[model samples]
Target chain A: MIKKVLIAEDHESVNISVEKTLEELGMTQTDYVYYCDDALARIQKGVQDDQSYDLLITDLSFIKDSRVQKISGGLELIPAVRQVQPDLRIIVFSVSCIPSTIEMLFGQSDIDGYVCKGRNDAKALKEAIETVAKNQRYFPRHLTQKIRQKNVHDFTEYDIKIITLLANGMRQKDIPAYLIEEGTKPAGLSSIEKRLNYIKETLEFTKNEQLIAFCKDMGII
Target chain B: MIKKVLIAEDHESVNISVEKTLEELGMTQTDYVYYCDDALARIQKGVQDDQSYDLLITDLSFIKDSRVQKISGGLELIPAVRQVQPDLRIIVFSVSCIPSTIEMLFGQSDIDGYVCKGRNDAKALKEAIETVAKNQRYFPRHLTQKIRQKNVHDFTEYDIKIITLLANGMRQKDIPAYLIEEGTKPAGLSSIEKRLNYIKETLEFTKNEQLIAFCKDMGII
Candidate 1:
């Protein structure tokens, strides 16, 4: 029963594609805006007129122009719009994979679904709309895990350092010297090796390279 | 139709939780291994006996131990097992959100599905198993978009400088001096401003602060 979607995205191609996908999904009452300000204005007007969007699909990285008067991006906009129309379903459609941003959208906002942009966005967007329409939350499987694995509580600075060095293709032996030079909490080479060893053990890997690969793959760098 | 499941995660808590989730999903024949070595061994033995795992759920960050003669991590073991038993259903349960690593797993390895560790992992894991068992490739929705949005080929050195400056909370007017100090590219304030503008547009944001927020949230710093 969800209809009358509002899309707030900066890219023209993506806007068209999302609009097309919604049409393909039999949602023809969709409105589009290329700027965050315009989208906000439309949402405000829609609310005042009592003809608001059932869902607001936005991109989190929309930049402001000289004519624009918005303080936040799509990530922040979700809450902003929710203040006026608390019942409006919000879905984020972007190409960003950073766990921190996704956590903010899911953890802090009133968002019902998050759909990524590009090739899979079209398919996923349809799935997200359908899922949210039923009052169910849908985060893409891989992203949901990535966002949940943030480990903001117990992560150490050294852990982040090792991850960064490994990402830059530094060998295991060379990592210690680099860490020592950085000097935040310099430890001996053996200690550095041991720390990595411990990390690998904790994560379930044998090679230091796998640790590097996992750190790099997880964006711990 | 999938029943028996093999879990190859190093963490005791995570492994136990995964096992519990599988049991909740009506899977009673769940096998757990703490190291990458044991996992590979189980798969090899299973292959020889022609009773391999219906689903191989593993975290790719396993450590290297000398006593264990098996391969190092999930990346290595995935292909190794695939060589022996091409149809083995392999799902990588990881905490990584790196574009390169995920791309490699999706491109180089024929992994049936991937799930992340943490709160969302338990739920996503069940969905991944169900989806992959149905013979469909399941890429997490947010990550699928991130991978597609990855324009690895488009970044220049100036882009890095701009990203670094933005990550450091530099204002647009102050960027020209920083660019001059860095001296990588010689250009006017307009050029530096233009580059930032381009980056902002590319990411789809409405303000420099949003750009900063985006980079910070994505762990690009």
Candidate 2:
């Protein structure tokens, strides 16, 4: 049973809804802050007083104001808060649905949960909180499937090199010449074409551009 | 001198900064609302009372809340507010930098100005407000240049057809075959290649995928 939770969301409406959702779970000892800096401060103060929060739910983006904030966004605040209290569970509550971003949060940041701020998000948040409370990770089912799909298709170094070149405006025919000049293996045009085709076929992408866009979106390149 | 202005921004910090900007301009009569529905209601009520606002500044995306709103976002609110108050100097204040979206707002929506919420956005907002007050349209210099570039290109029906097909996963080599079957003119592969080369040259793009992505971003296909 999670006792104390701190929410850092810039939107007042979202903050109110998150608080209400926490209350509905019969967990009333919730604190909220509108800025990332303020949230970090509260976490630090709580840790110093030996009254640390159990969970930290935060939004990624925050609109800049007149006051300068050292910890401007949630990405920076997560690590900052983690430094003070490594055991505190963190849940990212945001509207951003970028798969690559979500992947980074899960894989690199080691966040306990992610609840997208979409329709019926309050329900999602409740489930996320419950799961995190049990020391389990929670991610939206669709995103989980996407992460699984991404993991299954482990891109090779050659695949990444070609895709990066394509994304940087290198033509397919020109790619082999560039690769050959760089002394990369299998640098023939035929090899390049076959590799792109195979990668696209594996990804179920009909166009090379789609493959490129997907790579860019996934931050693979 | 603009007497009254209404700002519709969901973020409290942005709303405050906009208010401060207005105050700096010596225009004290400013009202702020966090919801599009509330902003529209204020505009409608003002119109009904014959004490209408001189200017309206709004952000396109709004964080959804528990309360159902008829005018959920600023895009819907723009036209609705325009219907009631056509003379209201409307300025889109947003972080969205998509050329297509901004182009539509300016070209189709007949908005008076647009100020992107980037670095020095407050200064931009002030300039936008001042320009709109003088019954002149305002857009960021970069956006204006992009609009000019788009105007210069003037994509033809054939151009759109080819780009649309490319965007839809059709290979350039296969495009002519599809075009010929569809009874399209100049359906030869040579002609298609020539047209593509010409478009790429005109757009200064090195790759067909770059051209395709650019077209998609500009909403040309």
Candidate 3:
């Protein structure tokens, strides 16, 4: 049901493909820009004219050019656009496959959707726009699975501190001593071992090393 | 000085930019194709016609379209092109920032150079082409640092095996026993402890956990 949409992508081919996809969805009133600054300008102008874009499709990494602009990338542009038009829905279309980067966009930046630029991405982009238009969140299936896997193994702050210390090369017996010196309560060797064992059991990790590696990969530590 | 070059990039804008860079370098006889099949065919035909391309600049991931082709990605195309023209200097022009993937291309695939597509990449790509033309390997400053960091700590097959076991949730104490059962030599607890200590010391890692995490990130285990 969304009529007005704006796309901010640096690559002309990708920008054209996105425009084509929007056309396929029967969206005739679409605006496209190759720079973040231009996109922001259009949004600001739209707001001033009392005609705002319903959604914003953007690529996170824009190829830097000779032009000097306040907004260098899409991450910065998102919050800037949000401030001008709080009702605008945003979807990040990027090639960044890093889980931590994607997690930050979702958790911290509060993006409505993320569609990785890859094979069949045009299809994925179409689905994302349609879903986000209905005021719903959308993430690719693989990313959803990754987010779910991360959520399934919820680690407490205390658990994270202990594992982080272990990853930093602290011996198991030395942890309690360090914890006590740092004024943490229940800093007993037995308690530390019990807590670690409980966490390992819950996560189905057989070794402390594996648990540490998992935490590091998930950016929990 | 290199006179003839061939670029294999699907995106029209990137292809144009790469051609422009070549033009800047005074290399006018540049051929470009949007498909890997066309690239390989061009190389084959070039060889047959007694005029081979001096350089092959390509991107790793090509966006798939309705047309089905055998040589879909750059990894496959590199080996194919190498078979037809062994002396053709190759440089991967891509947006991929994964160190491990780049490491594999350099270490295993034996590519001449890699120029990441990012800020000031046109300059980097020009440098890469020049360096590779002189039979020298070229990786960007950051990528070279990553490759050096990887090489600084050379892990033996035995070291990798032990770390893989540890990462798979096997305890250090249980590793010796498992090694003995698996018919691995010097499976004594003392030898295992000594090897672990040596690896940690060499890598400047304080903990066995850190060692495991490092190995995982580097794709060693």
Candidate 4:
């Protein structure tokens, strides 16, 4: 039941292709603007007329220009539109892979999906629109993996201590005593050993030194 | 065939639950490391032993030292492991809502997936693991919306000019002249009109003046 789509893309070919894709997908009421300002203007007009765009598909980078614009790029445009039209579904279809930019866009906007340009992700692009329109998140396989890898590094205080102590060659039998002295409840020796053992087993390590070496290499110690 | 899972988490209760989850999933070969150091060491050892883990799941916010390790967080550990084991399937699980940070993790590192710590996203997290195991991307629905909303303000030079001209009451016939004088390929009269028409149609504008008013209000002029 998707009716209107607003695309804010600067590249003609990308724009044309996306438009065609939408049409092919039975989204014939697609509209496009080459820049952020025009795109916003169009969306606002639609809102005023009570016919707001159902979704917004945009590119990350635009041809740079030095003039007073409401915003500078897709990064800036996302927040503005969200403020005015919080319910609008959005999809970022771009070629850039700048993580910082992508993160900023995600944090500030209410986008529904993200897709990379080029042939490899074409099938993913169509699927992104359909998924986002249906209120589901659509991130290409690798991007999601990247997000997970980043999350793993966010450790807790206890985790840090365990890693540091393990790196220092402290035996599981001795860890509880040291932790208890520091006002932490002493875990059973078997529990401590089991935890370390689990670490070894899961990471596929035969000994503790390998884990220690990795910690040191990563500067986790 | 779910294989071994390496958990680099610090919390006792959480770690236990994760272990239980693994057991429930019929994955008894689970390893739990409470610190980043231990996690890395174990992973390396496993790699050396030719028994590398099938999955490396870690918390993103682990503390190395309660006081001295305040600044060094989980994010610092990704690149280290990636260098040694580029093929490792790493997933980051955390409670951070920072879009830029999430984007950086997803975009820069060799991560496989990111899952938030909230109850609402727990199901998504489980799905994320399954997706990553299958080498697919998984962006949580809420997270994607925030990222998209953050980047809508970015605009380009050409967009500024067309918007300014439109604001000045330049007729559609005059737009091509302005564009050509600016050393830009002037879109045909119909083209210019069509672009504007699309804008108006998307925004639901009945007249050109409304679009102009919107631009001025957004500071696009």
Q: Rate the local accuracy (lDDT) of all candidates.
A: 0.68, 0.80, 0.81, 0.66
Ranking by TM-score: 3, 2, 1, 4
- Tens-place lDDT per residue, model 4, B98-156, is 55556767788858788765333335556777787678767666768866884433223
Candidates arranged by lDDT, highest first: 3, 2, 1, 4
Q: In candidate 1, what are the lDDT values of residues A14-109, reduced to their tens digit?
A: 565567668878899999877777787899999999898898888777544445556456755777787878888888886555566566568778
What value of lDDT does candidate 1 attain over all alpha carbons?
A: 0.68
**TM-score, predicted candidate 2 vs. hidden true structure:** 0.53
Per-model TM-score on C-alpha atoms = 0.39, 0.53, 0.54, 0.35
Chain A TM-score for each of the predictions: 0.65, 0.69, 0.67, 0.64
Candidate 3's C-alpha runs over 4 A off are A1-110, A116-126, A129-136, A142-152, A155-162, A172-195, A216-221, B1-109, B115-136, B141-151, B176-188
For candidate 3, give the lDDT of residue A167. 81
Sorted on DockQ, best first, the list reads 3, 2, 1, 4
Which pairs in model 2 have colliding backbones?
none
Measured by TM-score, the strongest candidate is 3
lDDT (Cα, 0-100) at A25 in candidate 3: 93
Using lDDT as the yardstick, the better of models 2 and 3 is: 3
> In candidate 2 chain B, what residue range of length 10 has the lowest lDDT sum?
B212-221
Residue B75 of model 2: what lDDT? 79
